[model samples]
Target chain A: MRTEKIETDVLIIGGGTAGCYAALTLASEAGGKRILIAEKANIRRSGCLAAGVNALNAYIIKGRTPQDYVEYAKKDAENIVREDLLLTMSEGLNRVTARLEELGLVILKNENGEYAARGNRNIKINGENIKPLLADAVRKCDNVQILNHVNMTDLLLADGRVCGAVGFHVDDSTVYEIHAGAVLCATGGAAGLYRPNNPGFSRHKMWYPPFNTGAGYAMGIQAGAEMTTFEMRFIALRCKDTIAPTGTIAQGVGAKQVNVFGQNYEKNYGITTSQRVYGTVEENRAGRGPCYLHTEGITGEQDKELLKAYLNMAPSQTLKWIEEEKNPSQKDVEIEGTEPYIVGGHTASGYWIDRERRTTLPGLYAAGDVAGGCPQKYVTGALVEGELAAKAIQKDLKESGADQGRYFAGQTAGNQAAAAIRGIYSHHLKKEPGPYSIDQVEEAMQKVMDQYAGGIGSGYRYNEKQLDLADEKITLLQKLAMDLKAEDMDDLLHIYEIKERLIVCRSLIAHLKARKETRWHSFGEHSDYPGKNKKYEKFVNSVLKDGRIQIIYRTLQKGDIEI
Target chain B: MSIRINKEKCVACGKCREVCPGNLIKIGVDKKAQIRHPKECWGCTSCVKECSVNAIEFFLGADIGGAGSWMLTKEEGDIRHWIIHKSDGSVKTIQINKKNSNQY
Candidate 1:
């Protein structure tokens, strides 16, 4: 195995939405500088949009301003969200979305030739090829380089600043040491952390990409960056069995949630989305039985279009409908709550970044699902964050004369870090097979999180005792993770992913324990302190120091943007 | 839902394993399509659309899907045709137009 040493101006981990857009932005503006994207999978069909998306969930359409979008986001997050990040994302949403449209994306239009609006801030689109299109656009840039199948294991930090990253090629098992002037981490969010609804072989049946095991969050935590809002995990209410997003039915086709009694129970309770999920759990716990997403009043055309939307995001739901001999035009589809996920795209949980998407750690910028403080940012907002991060990196480079030589600060420190990381991987290969397999360690972590943390087993609920157990068990699991051994390259990738997940798990437990009040309801339930307290209406930020996580609170201030 | 590969029909091209979003499939040592982890399957059917030999089959389990129902996928250029066979012997075909591959 040969080790490849590459030098570039900017290094991006994860060639998903944010990394691709960042590469595109820097290539166009950075004066012929090299931009490299290290991805775990092929960029043309990777990340959450690998199958494509049906609607632009964060578009600021006609009659709806960016301020309205920000206000709605604040409401969605229970009145405690980063107003600055939301305002910044909201202001650039339409511009970035329109740019995508010009780049060969087909935004659906109504008979009047206007953009088809789903809700107040969403527009319909035929985005089945969004990822491929973005990948193609990024490839067209001469300065951008994408290295697929390289799994980023850790950030290369020297003197508290990220100078590069270390990863290994999955196919050839060769180490890659990439040194850059700046590094952007946009590796999406953690999935498969809590026990998924369909465990075992069906574990990939999840709302988020199962492969994104919190690499971005873990790397940031290990680098001692401040992370916020891990307590406000995202628990999506999806279609039963398939775990498909219910937005296609609820918002796409104007369907409503009905009970097993064939009545509009959610409407009867006057509930919102989170309340609806809680109501369903309560109904089932009270022996009312299954709930359904009733599409009885939707027209045939609407139902057909709804299925098309499902085809874009999660086609399995449409196939399951056909296999079950059920059609939305006739009968309703069952709806259920999925396992909780720690994500920043839907919830406000990730690296604590300021206005420029810059983390507390110098030379390290966060974007996409890894950048905290904004919620409901979906695809377009990630693109905006990527663009902002790129501009900030470029401005910093220009100010420093572009050739100030960042990696020269600490050659000894860099070599020590690189050697330590290489030794960790080499030890796994040289040792006799360890007692615990990677899967067993992953299973132990997930079981502890699901049973004690705010997973579905406790009806998305948690008590103080359960949280304490989660903290203790997660710590033990973190120790156990070191003993995980691998026999092949694929196993090595899993070992790295599982290790990152445990690092993220520790932060999640610390934040959950710190937040005494139940703020986000089903998303972050605290049964011991069930009521929402105004005093606890702040962000829970944590930073690891001296082998212990120091948790703190940050006040959510109103931004000058008025959004 | 789970995907089943026709071992006899499979040419071991590994296109199905390459296109699967969940990374659930792999080529066995015997050079045949193997569903390594059936439970982790996200049922995207990218494998179904990419397999030129049309050797892959998908069906939902009895717990959710009834008996005698099946699904087959075929691609003609940019258009994918989903042939769904219902439990009642009736079949429905859905044509999904994909973005042109030549564009990129």
Candidate 2:
């Protein structure tokens, strides 16, 4: 295997939505600084925006203020959010949306030439090429270099400060040792950790991108960075088999959530996001086997609008509709809650960062879905976080002065970290076939999580006994993961993806046990504690210390506090 | 449903192989793109969109409302033309201009 060394002023991992924007911001503002983006796939179609989206879901429409957006997010999360992060993120939503428009994105405009508002906090857009546009803009920057098809395994740290990261090329055997003065992780969030809605051949058909395996969360957990709210997972309420976004049909045609009996049961539960999913589960349990978005009486024009909207974002849903020859006007779309996912963009579940997007570890920053405490940070919100982190990195690097000399001096440490990862790769390559294949191990992990950790199979509810069993089974899986062998580079990538998912699973189980209340309904339903407890209102944080997850509770940060 | 690559139309540009998120597509010894694992494909159509020559076609299985229909793409400048071939011998086309995608 070949080894390559790289040095950059700022290293941005996972060149998806946030990573691309962060690089664009740094390249423009931090003049002459070297910026490198290492992505698992090509940046033009990476992260959550790979297929594209139909609307900007976090904008402050007319008559709505940034503070109002903050309040909406706070109420949705049940007062367990970082108001500072939400406020800062909310304040930049329109700015970033406007920036995207300037970059050639097509935002739908009304007859008055203003942006066509979808709802109180969203505007429609034709964003199928959003990722490509961002990638194109970043490619124009002279100092930015993108490493496509590189899978980052671990972050390089010295004296508890991040110096760089280590990974290998997916198609080849080249190991990359990158040493940067500062690093920003925008790797998105974890999917496929729990059992998915579809099985076998169709397993990858889910709400979030199936490729996002929680690498950022895994690396940070291994490096002992504090994480928050793994228990408050994000369970998307989507179209039944296609798993497409229901927002288009709901907001576009003003469809109401109705059970099979044609009765509206949405308001019976609360109107919060979690409550919606929880209500569906309850309806099904109460003999209403199938719940749906009532679109029976919509006009043909509205049906065409729904089809066009989904085609711009999720083509599979549009294709399904076309194949069935039944439009929304004739058939109501069946809805179901997908498997729980650990995503900070939709729900707070990632690194505990301050307002400037700095994690507890120095020189290590996080943004986008990987940065916790800012929920409901849809596409525009992620762009805002990326900008915020880039600005912070510029200021911090300036204050610390040019540290190339010190960074180079840390080569010894970098070598040691690289050697450790190399050892694992070589060990896996040379090992005999174990009892279980990587696929088997991954399926086993998912089964354990589904049955015990509030996954879809268990109606998104878990008790202490189930969690204890989950912890024990997951620990055994981690041990088995170490012994699993890889036959080639492709197998190697699968091994690491499963390993990262396992690590996130361990952290998620601990957080689930630590928070002893059913705070967010089906998101984190604690069967043992069926009701929310005032004592458990604070954030449930954790850090891996001495090979064990240590739980820590932090008081809520309210209002727009200065850093 | 998974994607099937037509070797006759393939130029081996490797665009589809590079853009596949699952890394399921690879160039064979004959220098033609082949899917490594058809069952594992999620049918994202990223590869289909990237294949400029229409070498790749996504199979529309009977499971998700599609009964033996196939889909392909043809990009002409900024316009993307999505063509569908049905089992009943009928064809349907949807043309979308990348620049005016929001006009609807």
Candidate 3:
């Protein structure tokens, strides 16, 4: 394989929502600075917005204040949040929404010329091409370079600071050693960790992007970056087989959650996000299942609206309706909870970053879903975090007087990292096929997580004994993963993806065992503890030291708590 | 559900290959796009929208309530049509304007 070295002032990984926006912000604020975005897939249609979205889910409406949004998210997450991060992110929500509008996003406006509000904290938008718009803007910047089809494997560190990263092109034998003054990781969150609702050929049919295999989280964990709240997983309550979002019906048409007997049960448990999924699971366990969003008897106009709204984000649901020759007015939409995912956007489970978005490692900053402490940070919130991270990187680069020249001086460390990655890739290429294939090992890992680590098969519940088994089985899979072989660049990518998932699984199980309380119901249902404890209100943080997950607990940061 | 690419409709534009999130679609020696890993395909239909010639068709498998229907996309100026061919010799089309997508 050929090796290529790249030097930049700032390197942004995973050119999705946050990475593209961060590139735009950095290019606009600091011209002539070299900025590079390394994306595993093309930026035009990647990450969670590949198919697009129906609305800017996180926005400050006309009546609601930023503090009000923070309070809402804090309440939804049951007070285990970084209020400072949420407040900072909340304050910039509207600004980024307006920026998106200026950049050619179609935000719906009401008769008063105000942006249409979906709920208290969301604005309606035709966001099918949101990623393309952001990508187009970034492409126009002369100082930015986009490296598409490059899968980042690991971070490059000098001493204790993150100097750059190393990755390989997905379609070729070219390895890239990217060195930068500061690195901003926006790789999004992890999916496919647990066995999804659909199996076999439809395995990718889940809530989050199946391609986002928690590379950032795995790399950070390997580098010993502090991570928080991995136990607070995000389980989306979606339409039954299609796995399309239910929010379009619930919020757009005001549909209520009802059981098989058409009994409203959303309030029976709670209305919080986690509580919504928890109630669904509980109802199903109590044999009142086959839950649904009561969409029957809706007007034809509303049915048309729901169909078009789904086309903007998930067209499968719309297609399912069309194929069945049925509309929401005719039947209620069946809904179920997806396998749990570790995402910081909907639920906080990612890097433990400070207010400025700096991780524990120097020169390393995380934003978007990869950055923890902020839940419900949807499209607009990711954009805000990108902007926040860009501003912070610019300030840090200026204050530290670290330029491309000084960054290039760390080529020795970069060479060592590049060599280590090249060796790993070479080993994979040269190794003979072992007893387990990539799919076999991946399926085993998923089965272990599904049965023993609170996956949907277990109704999202687990005890200390189950977690211990999960830990043991996952460790064995990691060892088997080393003996796996790669046939081509495609196989190499799959191998790394599975490996990254295993690493995240290891850390997730550790966090699950550490958090003994059943604080968030189905999200973190520690059946051994069975009850929430005031003593366990602190954040459960972990850092990998000496090849072991070192658990650390820190008190909550309640910033400007006027609620 | 996976995708099937019709070589006759493919113009070898390479757009489908670039947009596939899984990188499952590749242009073969005949300069026609093909899905290398059909089983691994997530049926996201990103390639369908990017294909200007409607070369890629997503299978609506029976698992997800579809009775072996196939879906394709056709773009006409600012309007995009999602056409589905049902197994029972029926066709259904949904037209969406790119600009007025949020008119609701």
> What's the ranking of the predictions by TM-score, best on top?
3, 2, 1
Query: Which pairs clash in model 2?
Result: none
For candidate 3 chain A, which ten residues in a row score worst on lDDT?
Answer: A554-563
Model 1 CA deviation exceeding 4 Å by range: A267-272, A297-300, A403-410, A560-563, B7-35, B61-72, B85-91, B98-104
Q: What residue pairs clash in candidate 3, if any at all?
A: none
TM-score of chain B of 3: 0.84
Full ranking by DockQ:
3, 2, 1
Return the DockQ of model 2: 0.51
Candidate 3 local Cα displacement, residue A256, angstroms = 1.0
Residue A77 of candidate 2: its Cα lDDT? 99
RMSD of 1: 3.1
| Separate DockQ for every predicted complex | 0.32, 0.51, 0.60
- For candidate 3, the per-residue lDDT at B90 reads 91
What is model 3's DockQ versus the real complex?
A: 0.60
The candidate, 1 or 3, that scores higher on DockQ is 3
Query: Candidate 3's residue-wise lDDT over A349-404, tens digit each?
Result: 99988788889899999999999989999988998899999999999998888853
